[model samples]
Target: MDKTYLEINKQSWDEAAHRFFGRNPLPDYGPLAPSEDELNLFGDVTNLNVLEIGCGSGHSLRYMDQRNAGELWGLDLSKKQIEAAKTVLKNCHSPVHLFESPMEDNPGLPTNHFDIIFSIYALGWTTNLDKTFANVNQYLKKGGIFIFSWEHPIYNRVSNENSTLLFNKSYHEEGSYYHEAWSEPAVMQQYKISTYINTLINNGFKIERMIEDVRLTKEDIQRDSNRWYSYEKAKALPTSVIIKSQKL
Candidate 1:
């Protein structure tokens, strides 16, 4: 029998996890998205409980620690990633808790607990968004904030050729796909933008802000245009989406 996508992803990360250490971390949300310094999303995090979903290598957890957050907690499906996070956060000033488990599972985290929960380019890995959102809703306090950033849904459906952007895939089609651009095959979900917002609303979250702006710097633009995700392509359209929601 074929292995599950979850299993495949985990296995792939188990081997290649070190390559992504501290990649696309906080202070900045994700690739080309605005910095928290500009957006100030989680202002004054001092002594506040924080949890991270898909916290790879504990880079964001380290950011939370630097902010003097009360409790630093994270969960990831890859065991090796969790180990790397443990090493990264072993000397944190605040309490650090790491769990190796799928975001789809309950993992027995305290309900209505976290003051702020965020995922950086991580939520897209979930096979079941409804279950994941339901779990996130269950874990957050009323009025607590949830911030996450991921590759824009439309970014998946478009490609650039000779400085021209072309829509090659159906934006309406939503499901799992094998993104072979990585060294390993990445089995991830592709959902319409509405699905994300509606799912959050359905799970009792009030959308605070939905930012689709491209915030690439001059240095980012100076990168080679022939690269997989060219700065020119990113400038043409939003490559990342950052959504801030509050549990209600």
Candidate 2:
């Protein structure tokens, strides 16, 4: 039987979680990469009901909780990632409802329950943007905010190894792209920026803010010379994009 994309991703992430947890301690927000804090995307989440789509060990969930967010919930496709999240939450005396499910499949979460639905570097893994956005719209309360971040479409246009910032792939190509450098091969969808905006608008979301985070400093490059995608390359292009929208 052929494996589904979700199944392949689950296997890869599960293995990654196992290996990652073995070597590292529970992660905080910034060290994973540059954070959304600089943008202040979800301002003052205090007492707001928030859901994270691809919560991955619940670091971001915990971060929100610490910021005094109310009724925190998280969803991830990988069981190992959920397990790691549970462990971290338990140690911190934080209670969070974590669900193991794909974002596109409607994971039995209550409709009109969340004031905010967000993800960081996760939604790109979703194969069906329309279904995913529609599902998110259902779970979010009317006028609730939906914020997410993903690898910039432009970043994928260049060869992963090239620091010269040359276009290796057309920006219009939307399909599965494989990462060969990881210990476990990983696959992610490449979509034009318009696809995300159009899908959200079609699903009843109004765009509030959109940011392309390409803030690379000289210190950042000098500090991480051994990095595979160096700061020089990142400085020349947008590395990630963050979108903040509201359900209309």
Candidate 3:
């Protein structure tokens, strides 16, 4: 079956939507709500406009709503997720705008318009980094914050390994990047780490914070059966990286 990353996300999210939204009113891969520490990532957003990509069930949306932010909006590729988010938003006092769009597609928000744009564990699935980040830049105000998190390259590499010490699948030896989907006729496409970073800088974003960690709990290991990736090795290498940047 011919499928894109968004399609895969939609399917998985649709199946898991109940479990996801049930666990938390708003759920993202990261913290349930934007805390003071997370707020630090964006300096100040008391009344600033916020845009979130891949906002599965409006976890961040509810958080921003509580803060009484100027305007809160979210975009995701999954209609089911959008529906789940709207249901959650019913209790929210602030207004929220939702849109269905893939990151590679134009999001239709005004350029230089948002105070913050953030995503978590979403960019890793993107087919085009340049187009994605470039479009993100178009929506941000000058000096706006862009905070996101992704599967750490190291973690991705290790996860592909059968063991922490050995690879389950071989990656390009020449440093070529690859994008892989979960479903049928699995094909991997070439990409590059440099391309991702360059895409940000080239799109007028400057990296301010880059945090990498292995970050698996004992439960996480048990849940995975400990045979998947070398969690022990991941202890030494990072499984994810959280980045805080600014539109310069």
Measured by lDDT, the strongest candidate is: 1
Model 3: CA > 4 A from native: 1-12, 22-39, 159-164, 169-193, 214-233
> Which runs in model 2 stand beyond 4 Å of their true positions?
1-3, 18-34, 91-94, 160-163, 222-226
Best by TM-score: 1
lDDT tens digits, residues 1-248, model 2? 11388888888999888655422111212212355556676788778898989888777777777777888888998999999988867744345788998887877799998999988778888978888899999999999999888778877577544435577878888878786657777878889999999999999999998877554566544543345445665666767777889999
In candidate 1, what are the lDDT values of residues 14-124, reduced to their tens digit? Answer: 877988898879986766667788899898999999999999999999999998999999999899999999999999999988899889887879999999999999988
Better of 1 and 3 by lDDT: 1
lDDT against true structure, model 2? 0.76
Candidate 3 residue pairs that clash: 26-59, 161-167, 161-168, 162-168, 164-230, 177-191
TM-score of every model? 0.95, 0.87, 0.76
Per-candidate count of clashing residue pairs (backbone under 3 Å): 0, 0, 6
lDDT of 3 at 30: 39
Q: Work out candidate 1's RMSD over C-alphas.
A: 2.0
User: Which regions of candidate 1 fall more than 4 Å away from where they truly are?
Assistant: 1-3, 222-226
Considering TM-score, which of the candidate structures 2 and 3 is the better prediction for this target?
A: 2
